[model samples]
Each structure stands twice: as structure tokens, then as C-alpha cells.
Target: MMHAVVVFETLWGNTEQLAREVAAGLGLESTDVVDAVSAPAMLEDDVDLLVVGGPTHAFSMSTDKTREAAQQQGAENIPRRGIREWIASLASPGRDIRVATFDTRVTSPRLPGSAAKKAMKRLVALGFRPAAKPHTFGVHGYSGPVADGELERARRWGEELAATR
Candidate 1:
């Protein structure tokens, strides 16, 4: 079985919840789910998969500025660091490690860009192979009780990713 790490950055907890569900579907015994602030900067030798996720901000991943804006909007427990900074800090893996990316976005008024897409590109540049196409889960609003069935959908996506390994 593949060993996987799921790292997520969230403002309203929706992305973090999806990350947990995804990790659960990946088989909890083989997966480790962590918040971006606590995620490792380098992949362990035993890790075969790296899954990353964050909430979309300004059409892509959150920056310090965006995070501050979110805080101003009543978001609490916001991470000091976001996926962008965490990804920037990652050391290139010594071997090919499969990677997948996901994001949580508002359900209404379809977005123009994706944090997952940006994250996937960055991971690829750092020598990780794409395990699957980027995915997006929906939320009712910035601070959301995620969209009705998005959690289940995210788990299904994780299951599909596990099958690829």
C-alpha cells in the first residue's frame, strides 16, 4: 500500500475537513493528514504520495495578505502560513513521488482559477509526478459548512487516487 501525506491550509476549516475525509478514504492507517503549518518541509523516504489542498483566495492559493483579509472577515484560527509558503519551503523529493492537489471554493458564480491547479504546477516543478488531475470541492461561502455532498465527493476522489497507486 502507498504511504500518503495530506497537507492542507484552511481559513474556515472547510478545506481541512475535506483533507481529513480524503485521508480517511486513502486508508487512515496509511495516510497522515496535517495542517500546512505543521506539515513537513521534506518528504520522508517512505512516503509515496503527497496530497495538498487549500482554500481558493483571489482565484488561487492564499498569500499572507489574503489570509489577513480573511481574518478581517471573521475567519478565526487562520494559519500563520498558507499552502503557497509551505509549498515554497518544500525540498525536492529524491525520487518520484506522486502528487495530487485539491481546493475548496465558493459554490456560486463559478471561479476563474484554481488553487489546486497552481499547487499542482508548483509541485510538478519541484519534481513530483502528477497522480491525478486537480480537483475542487465546493463551499456555500467563504466561511462555509461545505457544500452538501462535497465531502463525499472529495473522499471518492481520494479513493480514485489510491487506486492509481
Candidate 2:
């Protein structure tokens, strides 16, 4: 069996729910998903795959400023540094570790960026191997019930990612 760890950050819980769906697709128990704020500073050495995700803020990963803004606007349990910080907190694992990234964003057709793409870049720069292209799930708005069937799509993506690994 593959050992995978999924870590994610969410302001409105959309991303967290996606994380669980991905984990299920990866054949992992719900306990394998960890919130970014509470994620271990270092990833476990034994994990075969590492999955990271979060909500896109300002077209990219959430920043300290964005997180703060969310908290001030009545968003509860906002994490200080989210996925961007959690990715930074990790040490180079030396051996190649398969990784996949995803993000949730508003459904504006004009929106031109994704945090998942940025996260995938950072993971590669940090020496992890990308198992597949980064992916995004759309929300109807800032606080969202994810677009119809997105959770199922995310799960399929997760399964495909495992197949590639």
C-alpha cells in the first residue's frame, strides 16, 4: 500500500473537504489528512507521496497578509501561514518524493491564476518529483460550495496521480 500524507489549509472549509476526498481516492484513511496550521513541521520520511492543497488567495498561495485579512473578516480558525508556510517548513527529503498539488478558487472565467500551479513549482524547486500537473477546483464564490462534481473530479485526479506514481 502507498503511504501518503495530505495537508491543506482552508478559510471556508472547501479545501479541507477536498483534501479528504483526495485522501479517499488515494486509499487513505481520513486521519491521513492534516490541516496546514497543525501539520508537522517536517513531513514523515516514510511517506511515498505528499499532497498539498489550499484555497487560492489573490491568484496565488495564501500569504501572511491574506491570512490576516481573512481572520479580520470573521473567518474562523484561520491559520497563520497556511500551505505556503507548511511547504517552507519542510526539509529536503534527499530522495525523490512524489508530489501532487491542488487548489480551490472562485469560478470567475476571467481569473487567470491558480495556487496549485504555484505550489507545484515550489515543490519541484524544493526537489520533489511532480507526479502530475497541478489541478484546481472552482467555487461559486469566495465562500463556496465547490462547483458541482468537483469533489468527484478531485477524487479521480487523486486516483490518476496514484496510477502515475
Candidate 3:
């Protein structure tokens, strides 16, 4: 049996909703959505997959400056460390872990660069193999309810991810 950890950094809850849906689609027993504020330094030994997510900021992963901008925009609950920092903080797992990454971005004429893609690169550098392609779920704006039918898409994506494992 495969067990997964779904962790995310959500400024406006869009990523949170997506993360829950994805975990549900993976047939996970519960939506153990770990926010960046509460993420641990390492994955559990029994975990088979690690699903990481966050909102894209300034065409890539959120930095301290971007997090500060989010806070300045009345985001009272913004975390001090984003996924980038979390990835950097992770120590070697002492075992191989399959990894997947997703990002939430606004739908625009020219989309911002994906945090998911960058996160995958970092994870690969740390020596984890990817279990799925980097994914992006679109938001309407900075603070979003997510696009129409995105939750279903996320669930389907999760299913696909599980099939690969």
C-alpha cells in the first residue's frame, strides 16, 4: 500500500482546497493537509509519496519578499517560510521518496512561471525521483476560489498520480 503526504503553502486557501481534493483522489484515508506553517523537516519513514504545493509568486516559488508582499495585502495568516524554504530545509530522508509538486497560479494571457516545476527540480537535486509531472491548478487572482471544475481536475490528477505508483 502506498501512503502519501500532501503539504502546501496557501496564501488564500485555493491551494489548500486543491491539496485536499488531490489527497482524496489518491484514496488517502484523510485529507492530511499540512500547511507550510506546520510542515515537518522530514517525511515519515512509511510514506511512499510526497505531494508538495504552493501558490506561484513573481513567476516562481515564493520568497521572503513575496511572502511579505502577500502579508502586506492583508494576508494575516501567511507563513514565514514558503515551500522553497521548506525544500531547502529538508535533510536527507535516509531513504528514497517519490515526489510530486503542484502550484496555483492565476490564468492570464502570459502565465507566470511555475513553482511546481522549480520545486521538482529542487527535489530531484536532493535525489528523489518524480512520481508525476509538475502540475498547476489555476486561480482567478491573488485570492481565489479556484477556477470552475478545478477540484474535479485535481482529483483526476491525483488518481493519475496514484496509478503511476
Candidate 4:
């Protein structure tokens, strides 16, 4: 059986919500969601793909403050984590896993593409082959309802990844 894991850092639950949508599209019978902060290193075991995401803050991945703001808004912080911390905790053996990245951001109607360059770089350093290009979902300001169609886009991305796997 193929195994996949979706890990993310979210603020105001927008990215987290997107993560769930991606997972649903993957349609895996066995899957797990872990907070980027407190997730264990062992979660990397034997996974076929790893889906990682975070809110885009200052044109980069979400920081510790991002998670904090989300929690401050009443979303429970599941161990208060960040990608840096998560990277520090990863076990060495799973470096061969495939990976794709996603981020939540405000779609600057004027800008050409979503700001996800850093996300792609991080995944490459972690040894994940992109199952698909890194994607970005739009948010309104700091928190988000998610711009129209972002969720659908995420679902499609998920399906495509699963098909390739």
C-alpha cells in the first residue's frame, strides 16, 4: 500500500483547511496530519509522498508568529510548531521521499504567480521530488476565507499527485 503524509503550519486555519482538502483528494485510506511544530520525526517512515504547506508570510513560509496568531485567534495550536523545528526533528532515513509544497497567500491580482519559491526550495533540500509544482492558495489579508477556487485547485493538485504515485 502506498503511504503519504501531509504536514503543515497554518494560521487562522486557512492552510490547515487546504491541507485537509488535499488529503481528501489524495483519497488515502491511511493518512495522518501533523502540526509542523510538535510532529515527531518518526512520522516520515515509508511514506510515498509528503505534502507540506504553510501560510506565506513576507513572501516566505509562515514563521513561529504565524502559528501563534492562528492560535491567538482561537485555533488551537497543536504543539506550536514551525518548519524549521520540524526539519530539525526529521529522521534521516526518509530523505528519499517525494514531496510537493503549498502555501496560503493573498493573491496580488497584479503579480504573475503565487509566491511559493521558498516552499519549493525547502522541499528540495529535504529530498522530496515535486509530485507537482508548488502551489499557492489565496487569502484575504492576514486571515483568509481563501480566494475563490483555491480549494478546488488544491483538490485537483491532490488528485494529480495521487495519480502520478
Residues 4-90, candidate 2: write the lDDT tens digits: 889999998899889988888886542378998888876676788989999888889999898888778777867776889888887
lDDT, model 3:
0.86
Write the residue-wise lDDT of candidate 4 on 1-165 in tens digits.
778888888757788889999988888887677768656776546688888888766556555675576567675643465665676567644457777888787765433433356766765775667677788788776666888888888888888888995
Steric clash count of candidate 3: 0
Which candidate should be chosen as best, given TM-score against the real structure?
1
| TM-score of each model, in listed order | 0.97, 0.92, 0.93, 0.81
In model 2, the Cα lDDT at residue 133 comes to: 84
Ranking by TM-score: 1, 3, 2, 4
Give the C-alpha miss distance for residue 139 in model 3, angstroms.
0.5
lDDT of 4 at 82: 66
Per-residue lDDT for 90-138 in model 3, tens only? 8766678888999999876457599999999998888788998999998
* Pairwise lDDT winner, candidates 2 and 3: 3
Candidate 1 lDDT, 1-165, residue by residue in tens: 578999999888899999999998886467888999999898889999999999999999999999999999999978989999999999999798999999999999887889999999999999999999999999997899899999999888888888886
Better of 2 and 4 by TM-score: 2
Each prediction's Cα lDDT score? 0.92, 0.85, 0.86, 0.72
Candidate 4: where is the Cα deviation over 4 Å? 65-79, 108-116
Please estimate how well model 1 matches the true structure, expressed as its whole-model Cα lDDT.
0.92
What TM-score quantifies how close candidate 3 is to the native fold? Answer: 0.93
